[model samples]
Target: MRTDWLGAEFDGVKLRLWVDGALSQRIVAGSPEQVLQTMLADLPVTDRPLLRSGWPDAALTPVPSAVAVAADQGRMPGLSQAAPADLMRHQPGRIRGFLTTRPDFDGVLCLIGHSTVWAHLSAGEVVSFRSFISAELFSMIRSFDALPAPADPADDGFAQALNHAMSRPAGLAADLAGLRAQVTLGQSDKAQAASRLAGLLIGAELAAARPYWLGQEVVVIGDGQWDAHYLAALASQGLSAAQADGVEMARAGLQDLWQMMQAKG
Candidate 1:
């Protein structure tokens, strides 16, 4: 309710990226957790729980006791019952959680967020419940947006979405040309140029290309420390989890950079 700053509904997804101290003010808004649950409902084939850590070593506050296991677990900003999801990792304000049925919960994959960690749920440890993400540093990761509908495997529209998704790299190539020119012209700071270049790659590779990411999981490689940090922060939240490796990130970014190089030749 209070922490309402930049609220722009873009491309069918409501995005709120904050700046300054407004990060602390309370937000009377919808739950990102719920949007994800509804998204998962449409993805029955996602029969496995994707577990991972969020940033800042976030914590969780599981649902109340005396509440039936089937009862909705109240968590997140709305403090309502989450969609029958179970906690894979539990800290005071954050959790790695999800739900799986139809296959008798076939396997427990490694839950990952900022990074992946192995978990051992003790007997009656009460790991299953509604949960919320709480972090001192990243306390403002309350991003709530809708995951796009799964593209129909048999539909042409699916192919178009993939095309739209793939064109992101092309867009980045175009943007990079202008930015690199600015760098040469001494019209832009090195840091700013780098940031812009990296953002293009991420927008094209991570967010836009997401619809066609092969594994239902995306490995976000960054070219520089800033990009790595960006991916790490997103990973910390329940967004697309990413891994950080200097060499790998360079390859992802440079692959696009090389396209520019080839064009020049």
Candidate 2:
């Protein structure tokens, strides 16, 4: 009955690890395939080691002697490749529904991560969800130019740009062009431009996803600066979100599945 979990997050650039229920290591280099292979090769053999991910592809990555489980499937009692969407329907006692109210918004639960956002809404007898690609947009912004060293989050430029985008989501593309123009004209420093670009892109996502967050309780997950930026954006709009450690949440989720499997015996 010994159960151990290996939870990993692959946020395009970095691969982070959590062993048991705590963070054990981080690998900054190598592609997702390479880093995962190297990390799994180094771990001590365990009969009950399970691997899970916040995103789908990470869980699909092959691991030696470890079973991979999709994020949503990890909450179930048995191993299955059921798509997350297929499990969205409410099942009465099997799948309970609840609402979360943030300071300024009220809706069902929303989990915002580094590259993606998941919002789940459960009515009395039906459930629905939506996903957004926020992180990928930010990454695209970073690829445009190398950001100046030591980008400070405290820069007012970032907040202003975020607010601007949130208020005028339709003008996001034009705003992006404006950032580049500012850099070219020496009107803004590279550091400030980078921060502002991030804010604008994330703000656009927030605007598009207003239905999920407009008046709902939100929980921000994942590691690094991107996650922090998300929380900051929500706060700027008078919305307060609870922060959860992504690593621990993944580990605990896997453990819950293991227990359910054991109880089914």
Best by lDDT: 2
Which 10-residue span in candidate 1 carries the lowest summed lDDT?
A: 4-13
Residue 183 CA displacement from its true place in model 2, Å: 0.4
Q: Stretches of candidate 2 above 4 Å error?
A: 1-37, 54-110, 121-126, 148-153
TM-score (all chains, Cα) for each model: 0.24, 0.69
Best by TM-score: 2
The residue-by-residue lDDT of candidate 2 on 4-43, one tens digit each, is 5554554445565655444555555646546766777866
lDDT, candidate 2, equals 0.54
> What is model 1's C-alpha RMSD?
21.0
Cand. 1 TM to true fold: 0.24
Clashing pairs in 2: 100-217, 105-215, 105-216, 106-215, 106-216, 107-215, 107-216
Sum up the clashes in candidate 2.
7
lDDT of residue 224 for candidate 2: 47
